[model samples]
Target: MCDQCISTVAASAGSRRRRLWDLPHQCHCPLVGVCFPLSTLRQLVNKALGGKAMADDYEVHVGAVSECLQRNRLSELLQKDLESRYASTVQAFRAAKTTKELAGLWADAVRRGDVAGAFWAALTHPRCDEVLQEVVLRDMHMLQHQAGAAIRVDIGKFNLLLREHGVLARELGKAQQRCTQLLAEKSAEIEQLNSQLVQQRAATIGKETRIAFLLQDLQQLRASLPDYENTSRLRKQLEQLAHRQAELETQNAQLRQQLGQAQRALSLRGPEDAPALASEPQQDPIKEAPITLHLGKKTVLCVGGRNGNLAHYREVIERAGGQFAHHDGGLENHQGALDAVLGAADLVICQTGCISHNAYWRVKDFCKRHGKQCVFVENPSTSSLSRSLQQIAQVP
Candidate 1:
């Protein structure tokens, strides 16, 4: 028998909360291992030996278990640490009024996988008996053997998971590389599309400029044709219409003067004279004024036409009672000043054949953005402008 066995033999039976020294000799080894970690055992043994170090962990554990067999420095330290560590568990066990109840708590604690705290608490419980102590010790011994087998099984599972993690990490790296490659390809495709769009826009502008030149050349060629019978006939009809318009205007003026004289004469006469005037043949009411261009106060801006024809353009606008402004469509004037001119005018007449492509688009975009009335004329002629103004007048 060892010192712990001798102590167990000498120990008296008691029905009270026992200290570590009062526990069975067999209980000491398991209790020391279960209730305390190796590091703590080392510390307690170092403290008990007064700073004298042990050769190995086993020796330290042995020393702690041996000290726990009696009242000593290591045992006291362990008692204090366990109480502090398992304070809540100790308080819970204190609720047990009988040994059978305390044993039930220990069994429940074992099923719940908390034997460390429950073991210490139950063994040191006030109602704990020798039979209850032996049962707890037996349960703890079987639990240790079961725990060793579980640790080996867990190690195998852990190794399998670690291998799976490595495979997943490699696949994730490959996926990221593929995504980056696809992004680079998409960026290249977008760049190509943008380049194509810019080229197409330039080509479109070139074609428009060519078409304008062709139209202007065609107009010049038609003007040079002296034998064009249609032109001569139209000119003659225009002269005849002008002459007839002048005669009608003169006749309207004479009629208005005569009606004014008659109204004055009637006003001067009495009520009896009004009846004689009614019996006389009544003169026809004057005809309503002919539909004509009337711009009121709105300004008309003419952009890009023959410089010599600018006076003709102004004359037509002013005759229609509209304010007139003009820009040379970036030919001689600054292109930057066009925006300000466009902003101030209420209407715009764009001579497409007479202007640069840049000026044409600038004027068109400005008119579109400001919601200005813009008339695009292919022929930059006085007759065309007059007809455009006449059309504007006819709109409701």
Candidate 2:
């Protein structure tokens, strides 16, 4: 029973010390015979209850408190020293130090129905401290539990606010990025519009230039309208003149054939009619040449003649049994080709009026050096060249 009492006292005292004061929580006392010191325990109880006040009715409970302490083998520790201050003789009773002894004293006070005595007894003695500490600890635990619940609720609310802010920030970032993309697309569209505008301006400039040129041409055509009528009349007159010239050339060809037939008929009369024809009044001989031209297959170079009519001069010389080649007055033929033709010819017929002064001298000089015969034609006509060739043929 004594060992049991000590174990119970130590357990309850440990609980009160942990709950109420700054006592050593890890008690090293052996459970079988441990007796806690009342001297030090009373000091701890006074310190713990220093903030509490005793009422005037404490005087009436002093006798009951003293009786309980005496029955429990407890005694007051500072009886002599406290006699002067406290009106109650509380210092006279032995103090209960251990939890078991305080419990027994409390039970006895309650059995005697001394409620005031139990209250004062629990505060003043160490052994009764476990009874009072249980009530205080229970009230403190209830307040702490309420505070923890309020703090947890505030933390949860703050977390919800943070998550809402994070979501808003993400949405704002997406909106800004979308705005940037739209701005870039608009910039590209504007650049394309600018390029098209430039091309349109260039096309407009080209069209304006073409329209100006067409307007100028229209003005020139209108100014020349009178000249168009005059040119048409001249063109008709030129065509009529060309038809008259063709008719004249046909008549001249017929006359030439008649002359050729008359000459042939006169020649057919032969030597029997030659003396009679000579005895009569002398008429111009029908043949221009009295005798045949005696050019023995020799080439004659005609230098510097009228360009288109050179064929007439060539035909005249060739009909008189001579070969003919002509230069276009040195304007159309090279000087070396003229020189070569002049060197190979047996005679040179130079139309001095048609040739340049230099060409006349060149032909004269070439004939003088090469011992070739040269004849000068002042007027380059077929009749003049025929007469010159006729006079030469009549030479002995």
Output the number of the lDDT-best candidate. 1
Q: Please, what is the TM-score per model? A: 0.46, 0.29
Query: Local error of candidate 1 at 385, Å?
Result: 33
lDDT computed for candidate 1: 0.82
lDDT of 1 by residue, 97-186 (tens): 887899899999999999999999988886776678779999999999999899889899989988998999999999999999999999
- Candidate with the greatest TM-score versus the true structure: 1
The residue pairs that clash in candidate 2, if any, are 74-94, 75-94, 75-95, 76-93, 76-94, 97-127, 98-127
Candidate models: Cα lDDT each: 0.82, 0.58
* Candidate 2: residue 9 Cα off by (Å): 80
After superposing candidate 2, which stretches have Cα over 4 Å from the reference? Answer: 1-287, 307-309, 390-396
Candidate 2 residue 89 Cα shift, in angstroms, is 90
Segments in model 1 whose C-alpha atoms lie over 4 Å from true places: 1-15, 47-54, 176-396
